[model samples]
Target: MSKKKGWVEQTDGYLNKTPTFQFILVTILFALWAIAASLNDILITQFKSVFQLSDFATAFVQSAFYGGYFLVAIPAALFIKKNSYKLAIIAGLTFFSLGCFLFFPASRLATYSVFLIAIFVIAIGLSFLETSADTYSSLLGPRRLATVRLNISQTFNAIGGIIGILLGKYLVFTDHNLQEEMARLSDAEAIKFGQQVLQRTLTPYIYVLIVLIVMIILFSVTKFPSGKVRKKSGEIDSAKFGETMNYLLHNKRYWRGVLAQFFYMGVQTGVWSFTMRLALDMFPHFNEKYVANFMLYSYICFFVGRFLASYLLSRFRETIVLTVYAVIGTVMLIGTTFIPNMIAIYLAVGVSLLLGPGWPTIYARTLETVDDKRHTETAGAIIVMAIVGGAVLPVIQGLISDATTMQFSFIATAVEFAWVAWYFISEIKYDIRSTVTNKSHSLED
Candidate 1:
């Protein structure tokens, strides 16, 4: 009992040390990204109907968004390395606001391609925000508290996701009668109605754009703690792409974490992308609004799970907790796959609880292993690049769903979680405590 109290005190000490305002700002940034990301699920459903697309085609929404993450990661890393995290954040907001505003043109044009372009641009902004915000949050306090800080921030992120889904459900998702009416119209009339439907989708984004603009102004004027490049003997050694690539390739643990992250992201994005589909499949009478609410519930579970995991992480080793969660997630996915009823739906929702801690835990764990602060930015970029898995796996799942059934497509998610569990088990010997001790020693020396 005393030992548990000591653990809580230690974690609280670290939390107390973090600058209150900075933490709040960073948490809000985390929430902003979540709001943007969750909106994609709504887009997938709406675009499918709006553009008359197939499952495989609807999957392109993820492709375009995460593809932007893949493409912009390195550049975002370079920008942060050359500048500061504050600048990177502002630049990210610039792109984010611009992308939101672009929805205006996309809506006016009423072209799916243009909407994809807007989403891609927004993703570019998000890539910068994610890389910078993640690193900044991790570095805000004691290295040991990195994952906890990120999880706390991500709790707000889940809240943002809930808000996004709700907004999309109420504002963006058209009424069933409207959809039915559009179906009955002549070809030209249907196109006009579709254009009107697409234009309505722009409203939420406009509101988002306004909020982003306000954030940009606030960020520009407020002073942020310097996240400068760490130096050895007051000399800055610029990271070379080739050398960094070689080093990362040679590090077995590093690459393995990368792979685990890839599969984890794939499963996460794939599952959320298809949650509504799976729900509809199980209950054919249900509407989009019902599925959206379910998605909101899943994120609520996600929010609560993050806090729960953060508590567990305080008491246990991160890798052990991660391994346990991964295994549980896999079991849940298996139940979701084999069980075909309302029970399967509940099991699928349970997967969110298990998934809540995996991403931040893996990220903080992987970054702990890296010895050089110089490499941290590049390392972050590589991890962000792995988000392309969100693009690749979901599309594959979509194709599989098109070929088979939605329940069967979840096999991909199950397999991915199995890999994550295996990763934690295989790398159990490389514990974070040792890495933190080494870092402390190096700093003292």
Candidate 2:
């Protein structure tokens, strides 16, 4: 009988000389942000019901959250360059905890705009965490296997997403017919009920806030690997934003990645934001709490997909695996849009399975475009900024849903995945040509 290999064997030395403990510590940061982001989906339905918002208006939940990622990513990168990834992680956790703490007051105020403010603050912190953690994870292993390593880390992120949706399903979503109840109540009674829903929303954040505090303390004490060791403070060249931006602009591959990430983020956010809406629309008998069960299942598929993608990435070409996922995702989303049946909605939920490998794969590939290691931090920041698509694309979907049916709105996500498929196809073509050219040159030699 053959002996079974462990995870280290499976990685094929991708983890060679990697700082195991530091990687574990930094990987936790992935889950931290994912929990916050996934909870936003629950918030969208809760806020829409409590505040009586249109689909378009309710999407501002994503807009405010990802908008902070857009604005803060560059500054967070600069901070990491001047300071350290470890410090940036701590700063992010602090900001996150602060934002989570604000949920108490936001709940008390029971104002949509105020809650958006708290969510934006949380996004600010997440921007810091993402800017630091993703780049940090890529650097933890061999450059070639960066995607695989990041995917391994992202598995925890999937777990966090699952936990978040579960928390929202149980703690936030109410079983009662909120619309009918609100319609029947007097103004004072409605306000009281709104406050109660807001209180339920605030409970999850409190648990998250406690976890963030613990993480901050743990990160402070742990020793993290330094990407670039500097003996003198003067060796830190933090003023290279202009140079880095110029370099990034000229890199075609990196821009392709940026576009892919943009669409992917948008579709990912929009799909989850409206999943509950779609569930309720398709099956009128389903309550918000029951619809949330589909979200839970969606995240579970995502969790499994991450683990599966990571394994496949280790065994196969990253471009090949990603291309397959993108293609499948595009087709599934198309089915989700046009097919008017239970299967159509199931396709939407199944999209999460394809989504698991996207962000990390694009991220690792984009960073590979930068030949100079010095620009990695800045380049990583700009890529993180592409997450703003989460802010923009969801609103576009929302507008479409409001104008058409919820089923038709998913056309936008289908288009987004089509772009990802094209990007990965181009990657495969480039790799093939490069391989052919190198082999021919070797024969001549």
Candidate 3:
């Protein structure tokens, strides 16, 4: 037996098995993911002004950004599937750094479309990182300790989000009005002012670009552990893509996770994507920094939730725990629905505290329920489906915000959590199924 241990046992083993350098390297790599992942939030108001767009068009910014996830998921999934995880990560980081560098030029060009294209490219690179990184982390230590390892590494990602919000708020927004004022003049006069806008932001991004490039170089050289990391090989069978799609479609537990992830993504994305807009519309007392800090705290709650899962999931049945979490989440959303004040904003963001562990628990339970060989393909699809929530939901929220008040936009988010509550219900039903079936099988075995 492979020990079949739980989180505490795994935590003890981790203290002994983990090396110091691996921690440093993984933290740095995690920072990369966080910074890149959160680039959109930092630039929200800038994009709105520069593009002269409504919430609808600005919404596509997320779609275009995350749409790359849908486009690249298959190939990236297969790439990691067919090759070594190391190779996939190397490729992912290289392109991700490349994508980060693209912002340099897009900033210089001052072209909105080019900026979206840069984001698309960056997301294409991130698609690989998103799939590979968590799966890679899961394989790093004792299986039960996987959540701890991932949670620790992911804290740096939140750190990156904080830095992104600060830099965007400070650096990007710094001469935004000047850029606007210069635009009021003729093209030539505005060009002079435009150069200033580009120059100010352009320099800071260059610094960020150089730092990321250096980190990429370091990650390339560092030796990351590949635990039970099997690299699948063979020709690029186009048919396998179709087969993988069909495989997941046929598997009920797997699809259940897929739907769970969909709603989860919607909830997560809706909260983060609309926080700035919502704060402004509802809580006039709070400024952007307050909203930013509010998000940071909510994300901190997300981290706390993940770590708490270490203890919680082990003691209670996973379904019961998940059910309670969902109910809490639904209640919070409902609370937000009733309150038009900052109470709603705080409650809405606070839901992240309950959500942190849900995905990993779902991942653990679903993968355990499925065939071993399918892990990589299914992981890819599930994570990618998560991006679909990012793609579709935010755009819808954006359109909805434009149509009505941002306060009313909470309804779209409510629909998302309702689906999540149902996912928990399914898990409860499945838990009952597993208990009886296992009892019967035990008699036979």
lDDT leader: 2
lDDT of 1 by residue, 363-396 (tens): 8778767776657888988888888999899999
How far does residue 430 in candidate 3 sit from its true spot (Å)? Answer: 3.5
Per-model CA lDDT versus the true structure: 0.82, 0.85, 0.66
TM-scores, one per candidate: 0.90, 0.92, 0.81
The superposed Cα distance between candidate 2 and the true structure at residue 36, in angstroms, equals 0.5
List, residue by residue over 127-195, the lDDT tens digit for candidate 2: 999999898886675556676668788888998998899899888887875666787989999999999
Residue-level lDDT tens digits of model 3 in 342-440: 788888778877877666666556655545444455454465546677788877888788888776777788788778878878778778887999999
What lDDT would candidate 1 get against the real structure? 0.82
Estimate candidate 2's RMSD in Å. Answer: 5.2
TM-score of 3: 0.81
User: Where is the poorest 10-residue window by lDDT in model 2?
Assistant: 1-10
lDDT, residue 382, candidate 1: 89
Q: Residue 398 of candidate 1: its Cα lDDT?
A: 88
- RMSD (Cα, Å) of candidate 3? 5.5
Any residue pairs clashing in model 2, and if so which?
A: none
Q: Count the backbone clashes (under 3 Å) in each candidate.
A: 0, 0, 0
